[model samples]
Target: MYDSFRRDGVWPEFDRVDRQLLRAAKVDVAQVAAQIPPDLMATDGPRGVPPRGHDRMRLTVAGIACCEGGREDLDLFFHALRWMAQHEARHYPEPGKTSVKVTRAMLAKALRIPARDAVRLRRLSVLLRDERWGSVGSWRSTDDQDWSVNVGRDVRYFRRVRSTDDFIAATTAWLEPVTVATPAADLPGAASPQSPAEHGSYVDERVFDLVRQSDGARWDCTKLLALLRELDDNYRAGNAYAAHALLRAVMDHIPPLFGETTFAPVANNHPWGKTDGRYMKRLVHFRDQADDVMHRQISRTPCVLTMEDMPARAAVNRFLLGCVSKLA
Candidate 1:
């Protein structure tokens, strides 16, 4: 039924929406959606099935903007969902159909809610699973206490359909290309790459907390924070040269955590897994690019490097996570 919702872009069954969880007198998602302007709602075309046989409506990108703006909980819940999706790819016990294992504790940690307030996870999950809202898969509870949810492969709904201004700004500022590779449309099951702003937000928040808690040299923590902030600023400003130089600075500064003085030895000698090692090699290559950006003399020809030369967000996060682990 949830799968049908994904395919048809309408709730397959209105009976599924828990009225008690929604805390509304009437369990009418369609009524709420009708209140929104038709321009903001999903098109009543082929995919947008009519609200028949207890089916409810799905919102458009603009509709989501209006609804989420008023509902902070909905916005933050989606943040946790995105974070869970990333974590599903990152962590061990590689996920299958049901990926994220969401216990009250885990959800609380993800949302930074106190344990006492953790009951809200149930309500949050209900709202997110609603077709008129997040439009994700159904929640399957494990052990009657924790829920396992899948991010799923069909992510058309996950794709950011935004205002023209927001789209242009995001593309110009946040699109840090890891390479001049083939477009995603040419690759099978390939989604667009994560933007720097998307992944960096988590790193920034986690590292800030780590810095506050760290017993390491205060100077080192301050320096690390400053470098990370500047790298992010350069990315947003589309200053690829400054971003490259700052990435190198980060590489040069954090080797002590891996029981090494320089990044080369850390890459070569650290007993991390092959995946992490691959990222380390990529960073090493990025370091070389940074050197060129900082020291290369003006040439007769144009410089070939652009923002496309920036390292992958995952690799950068892996590098910083290593530092974070050691600091924590």
Candidate 2:
């Protein structure tokens, strides 16, 4: 969308958000530049977001020619991704669809190479360069929902990592690519060819400990409370909750949201003659009636809450009392 004040007056950034997405696709900039058609680059209409850095490939090759890659190969590169996306869209339409991977895997196996390399292995790789690829714009923490998606994986380096700003750095790296061609020295590491024993050793006791932590109920009850608290904070911060997600995300080396584990009940209950308001027996999740024994934190702005929230707060202090009693 283009805007007089915006970068493109007719082609505003968010207007074509999916077009800006770069997950997995032609990683080489020079090759990408050679592959894309001017029509694809032109600000026209709704465009499909391709997997594995497809956004970068789209940008690099959209309207330009490059030093590398013949036009035929470039065309093939675009077609290959189209074919992959078509196969995926037709067969699988939701998150974590296996059809795309399965199709790519079958093709890769027929030719004999790893899956990621299959991207670089295509004839189009010859044309793509490093500089052609870049991130759309700012980083969002919510992108973690698609962390395992093909595009998500390709853009993982751009998401929150060791540094919350890692995504920007990584995107910048791709944007300023010297070449898509890997330096021979970094090739071995980049290729990700792990031998059996080396790979096994990589998953040492530390890894096991981490894996155990996800499903582990072996910790002191106090730690369990800590975990619950963390989940509470996450929900408060606009994240959905499932015990599994909480454990899995926390245990993972890189979690989207970290450093919060405070659990508090959002409802209240009492046993006595009816007081100020209606006395409900069961736990109502987020309803808070200050008029009654039950109190509710007024639903504040900047928070997405459900209408079905229970007003009852957890018996946290009571539970702690139980824990202390057990200790005594």
Candidate 1, 1-328: lDDT as tens digits: 2333333334335444434325656556545544646655543333434343344544533344455232454455556645554454444444454343445566668778765554355545544454332223666666424665555422222333234334334334433455566676798987434334322332344444455457464335878888888887777666767788888898999888877888898887876588988998888887788889998999898877776678887788877777777776
- Maximum-lDDT candidate: 1
TM-score of each candidate structure, all chains considered together: 0.48, 0.18
TM match of model 1 to true structure: 0.48
What is the lDDT, from 0 to 100, of the residue 170 in candidate 1? 37
The alpha-carbon RMSD values of the candidates against the true structure, listed in the order shown, are 10.0, 22.7
Worst lDDT run of 10 residues, candidate 2, spans: 194-203
Kindly report which residue stretches of model 1 are placed more than 4 angstroms away from their true locations once superposed.
1-72, 75-79, 82-90, 93-98, 103-122, 131-137, 141-148, 152-240, 258-289, 297-325
lDDT of 2: 0.31
lDDT of each: 0.58, 0.31
Query: Best by TM-score, which number?
Result: 1
Question: Lowest lDDT 10-mer window, candidate 1?
Answer: 153-162
Candidate 2 lDDT, 74-119, residue by residue in tens: 4443444333333333343346442223233343444355655433
